[model samples]
Target: MYQQILAPLFGSLGWSAVAAALPLLVLFALLGLVRMTAWKASLIALAVALAIAMFVYPMPVDQALLSATLGAAFGFFPILWIVINAIWIYQMTVTTGHFDVLQRSFSRISGDRRIQAMIIAFCFGALLEALAGFGTPVAITTVMLLALGISPMTSAVVALVANTAPVAYGALASPLVTLASVTELPLADLGAMTGRQTPLLALFVPMVLVGIIDGVRGVRETLPATLTCGITFAVAQFAASNYVSVPLTDIIAALLAAGATVLLMRVWTPRGAEPPTSEPAGSRAEVLRAYAPYLIIIAVFVVAQLGPIADLLDAVTLKFNWPGLDIRDAGGEALSLTEFKFNWLSGAGSLLLIAGLLTIPVIGISARAALGRYAATYRQLAWAIVTVMTVLAIAYVMNTSGQTATLGTWMAATGGLFAFLSPILGWLGVAVTGSDTSSNSLFGALQVTAAEQAGIDPMLAAAANGSGGVLGKMISPQNLAIAAGAVGMAGREGDLFRRVLPFSLGFLLLMCALIALQATPVLSWMTVM
Candidate 1:
């Protein structure tokens, strides 16, 4: 192994680091070029990663496998837990007919396809991203846009793009919580810096989403609404993350945007000819019944996740760290690794259960139908869960194995242009797996380290890692599968990726520009001007 993988390379490096990294580069190359399915790619990557750890990096094999297993399990349950429940809640709305009201409500706000896409997928979805993120916004907003007669491709694109601005604060700001715990940056400081950094991205998101949907004309027409949503979202993200705990930022931000947009849409009509009229409204009682469960879920989720009563429930949490995966600080000191344990009482999963209960009575969902739908949504999410687990396992291995360090060392050699290259690393992460959570988990720490080494502010760089990563979501193999599954576009995943690549590249450029601004003294303009 050393002869073929290490000797000549080591000669140049004067060490075995070269041998240690060959496996990693090969794994990434094969995945990038072969267009292999995620499962296969993850397996291959894991295998090479294992080999590197044991032979080159000298990590114990059992320990390596155990770490990978624990990481995989974490990816499968709670992460997948969020995705499945989010889809189920939306499915519950659809199966019970409340979706029609949702569609009409969106249309009444702005019937133009572009504006509607911006509102539902961009602004509204960002709110959801802030609230329940993971895959929730995409599942809900895409379905709603489709219900409103937007093309399936358009809906998926809009949802994926809108997913960007709110991700750091998503699912009640879990990302920031994770970032804080890992970095030991004051949660408030990280939250505040992320808030300051992300709203900067938020400012441009609506303009990007609208331009994508209907071009300059559409952007111009919906400028008022777009600007309002972006500013509101940015300002809220800045304040919520700065003042409040990270865990509640997304929840509060999303709810505020939803409430504000809902209230505003009542009186704020937009310019241009609206689309075709939607069907008449459903009975108020029917709408109320249809939505009761979701209301309960949100209510319970909010109270349990935060609020005065949360401590009582939170007292019953499941907490522990994965043993044997001690990471390092900037120096050689080992960083404490605590993967927050699942708390059944206060965990997001429990809130989902609460939502379902409140929803069942309100929607008049028969117990039989509710059980059937819940089961079906689980089945739908199972493979996705597997995919996330598999990919995350590989990612965790690479991260803990110091493989990312090996890679980061090589990349950081490009001193001045590191800002430009930074986004690609984030992009490749999300491109491999659909969810930004997965991407951020895979690279968030790496970005921080890279930023510090490159003499850049870690928060600006970390936020760019997130914002740039969002562009890849549209083309992620998992996302393609979901959208295709939703619209019967299966077996044509390649076609969809091919179609979306240009837009993906374009938006990535926009994000890259935003990230570069942070490093450049001139970027004060992007923030101030």
Candidate 2:
């Protein structure tokens, strides 16, 4: 088996770390500075990473190729698979003319652009994040925001930003679960600490969404509703994660947040906001029919996640060790190097596809037309698929070649200030991998290790990894591609990244401060014992 060499070329950790980071820097410069399309930038970055893996890190050629292939397979099977089918269901609704009715139903709730954003992007998006995650919220919510007459760019930005708070607990709290597993901490402790940290962001995000949607006026006029949504969500999140159930944290929080927003609107309307021009109310049957697609989605996802059904579906899962990619870390611990966990039956993508197929008869579309829509979606998402795959391949290369470990090892040398720097590792992990769960798996142990060295609570440090990583989702290449596709801005992933970068960085800084304070006596009481 070929082993990775962290400082293969320069024999210096500092120079090796910089060499390891060159591909990511190239990717960011190309996408953020040179304004390259995501697909092209990803391709170039993958090329750079391969060269670095083979030369600077000195990974064998066969291992490098297999790693990239495995990453691409994973990108297609689960990640892009979910994106394609979720958008296909939305397209099916549009084809059947139900989307218009759905839009009217939402407008009936509130005509104000700000309120619509709060409902669709913040509240409803959280529900999606809970159920499906992995770009599902960005894919679905951006489209919904567009249907409500928001600009495509604004819709994409709002969806990305609103997706943050729910993400630590997303996919049934998979990120926290991964953190617990990696750090050997109790799930309850990790959940509670994450609960403490992310709820602060939960309480702040709705206001930020409003600010993004309509500037100072939006925040000023909709202050009551925004505060209500954020505070209720935060309280519910903390209670659910700490006391009730970790997996159901986002779901319960989302339901309560939406309910609170509706109740608040019953007595208060924002000043200067005109009532939406009343549209003809559909019959109860018509409204339910219009919502049948989502109802089907909920049913399929729920059934698929049921214990027995999930077990049966998981039985069909295909797991394989990546060839020639196994490597050990500095401490002689073997890295968990595997690839393409093809959860064919139980995956969210399959559930979404089942939901779309069920929609065909409900929405009055023939099989032929539904197939046509599927093909059209494939054509539209062609570049996005390539972008995701290439980026993931780059991530795989970085991980297998020890480049990621190099960066983390260098960061872990921060000593006492490692508390402030802990979340940055998480942020970097997710920004590179496009997944909070993946980030936790990558850096969870590192956080605990660094915390022990620096004399801080390992639980708090590990939780910070997950909590802060959520911010990076907004600017991740996979998310940018999904957001671009959702808004019909296929080649403009760069634009979406640029729009969300400020919010991502701003939240990262806030999380750093929160984590830093928790490490000290000032906010030590905030953490779970």
Candidate 3:
């Protein structure tokens, strides 16, 4: 590993860092600038990582293999699990004919297109994100928008934008929980800090999305509903984060916001009546029964995550390091085994499955039809699942192989502006993978390390990564694909990205400023990253 191999490449600390991070930059550029498929770009990034590990960083081949395999596995389980189940639950409704009733009910509540966008894509999505996360909101929200006759591109963008506020507290507070675990920070503090920060944005993203879709008039008309929705979410977020468990914030807040909207719709109609519906009304009890599955899911997840039950369920957990993969410092020394392990039972996947099981009865479809619907759902989502898995695999390969770290280090050394560069790192991770969770996973450690070196609050930097990651969601390849498919622009993926790019970048900058402000020593303790 010396002279001809590691020395020429990883010989200097500076060189090693550059080698780790440059490929990551190139990966994002290829996707953002060129509009390549996520998996395709990921493969290119992975190849670069392999080169670094074998010839530059010179890790043992076995470790590299193990790490890559483990990373891919991590991508599949819980993450894919969540995405697939969401689509399945929705499919059960569609197949049962109850979904049409559900739609009619939603229409009856608030038929104005703009308000529908707010309640479903923005507000309802938050409920799911908080409850189940891992692409569930997007999957559920995107489909709902499409059914409502909202353009697919519009649905995708709104859902992506709407997704922002719930993300930090999403998957029942997974990001905050993960951050605390990784950094040894207090879980409650991390939850409170990120929670307060998210609601501040959550209060506004809905209105912003409305303006983007419907212009100024749309914004004006929906002001009252927006305030009720936004304020409820923000206050709930702040209170929950500061005083309660991270997982519970989105759940309670979403329930409150959704409740407020439902009540408001009953008493206050908008300027125009709802869109006309040809569908017949079903019994309210039947509708309630139809929705029982979701209620059960939430109830089960809460029980599963709480107190003795959660700890007892812990026995089912299986933890082991990903095979062969190892990290190294500038000196080419290997990282400890603690660097790799799949977090399974504690993950959202388990919750999703439990939710799905509970939802099956509520779906109310018979066995034969249920199987048929499941098959059809799979057929419709084949491209999405393939895209998600491949992209994740490549992301893991590139990361575990050490190329991303080298590249971040290189950028850090050359560009000493921590605040400016730090957000960019988070932004790039999101741009590549299109998942905030993935973005945080990729750069969370790096952001903290950079902040410490720069002498800023580590929590602030970690939060910045999450904040910037939201911008990438609008332009990410996976997201673009969903948008294109939703809008019947199947291959026009590039067009969707081009359209949303500006807004994504703009909001991202705004978030970065917010994060920087929150990170100050005086305010830092007030909000955890």
TM-scores, all candidates, are 0.80, 0.98, 0.85
What would the per-residue lDDT of candidate 1 be over residues 287-337, giving only the tens digit for each residue? 566546556656676666555677888787777766655555334545332
Better of 2 and 3 by lDDT: 2
Question: What residue runs in model 1 are displaced by over 4 Å at the alpha carbon?
Answer: 1-37, 51-58, 211-224, 235-272, 275-279, 321-340, 413-508, 524-529
Candidate 2 has its poorest 10 consecutive residues by lDDT at 323-332
Error of 2 at 194 (Å): 0.2
Candidate 2 Cα RMSD after full superposition onto the native fold (Å): 1.4
Q: List the residue pairs that clash in candidate 1.
A: 130-250, 172-247, 289-363, 293-358, 293-359, 297-355
Q: Which has the better TM-score: candidate 1, or candidate 3?
A: 3
What does candidate 3 score on TM?
0.85
Per-residue lDDT of candidate 3, residues 1-529 (tens digit): 2111322363675666666665565566666678775456656766676666666766566656565566556556666666666667777877777767777767666777777778888778888887777677777788888777777777777777777777777776766666666566677766765665567677777788788678788788777778888888888878877777677888788878878876776677556546534454578776786566567667777777788887877776776544434455445655432253344665666666667666766666677776676677656666655555555555554555555555566545533367656666777777656677767766777777888888777776776777676667666666665545433455455556666777777777777666666656655655633
The number of the candidate with the highest TM-score is 2
Local error of candidate 2 at 513, Å?
Answer: 0.3
Q: Predictions ranked by TM-score, top down?
A: 2, 3, 1
